[model samples]
Target: MPAIVGAVKVINVSASSIFHIGDVYAMAPKSSAKTYAGGGSFNTGSGIHIQLSDSHTYVNDNDKFDQTIIGT
Candidate 1:
């Protein structure tokens, strides 16, 4: 197997509530990273949670959704 190394980063969005696992969310890129605000899938719930390899330097907020809300 290949070796992995370096820092760890994460992005999280909350729906101001609780949810279950295997839920999906539509997240926008953190205001800091140049990543675009597109539709992506997540395994967690309530909000969106993403993990990266390093720290960030910008403000971020995302619009979250589920398969039912956005449609499947």
Candidate 2:
């Protein structure tokens, strides 16, 4: 069986604006804890950017996944 891999990213706003403050949070299964890709709050002239990915090549065979993201 091949490993299940994927990635996700989110932002609070998607328009031409400035972010005075921003925050981000992400989490994954304990078994694949190391698979947590880099993600955090970023200030942008148009909006905030959050990037996340799953780099684990040995993930389980399951195709189901759960993720959480909090931003402000």
| Clashes, model 2 | 0
lDDT tens readout by residue for model 2, 15-68: 433343234254332322223333353345766665556433344646454542
| Residue 23 lDDT (model 2) | 42
C-alpha positional error of residue 54 in candidate 1 after TM-score superposition, expressed in Å = 54
The per-residue C-alpha lDDT of model 2 at residue 10 equals 42
lDDT of 2 at 27: 33
Best by lDDT: 1
RMSD (CA, Å), each prediction:
20.6, 21.5
TM-score per candidate, in order?
A: 0.15, 0.15
Q: Lowest summed lDDT over 10 consecutive residues: which window, candidate 1? A: 29-38
lDDT of each: 0.43, 0.41
User: How many pairs of residues collide in each model?
Assistant: 5, 0
Q: Return the lDDT, model 2, position 16.
A: 35
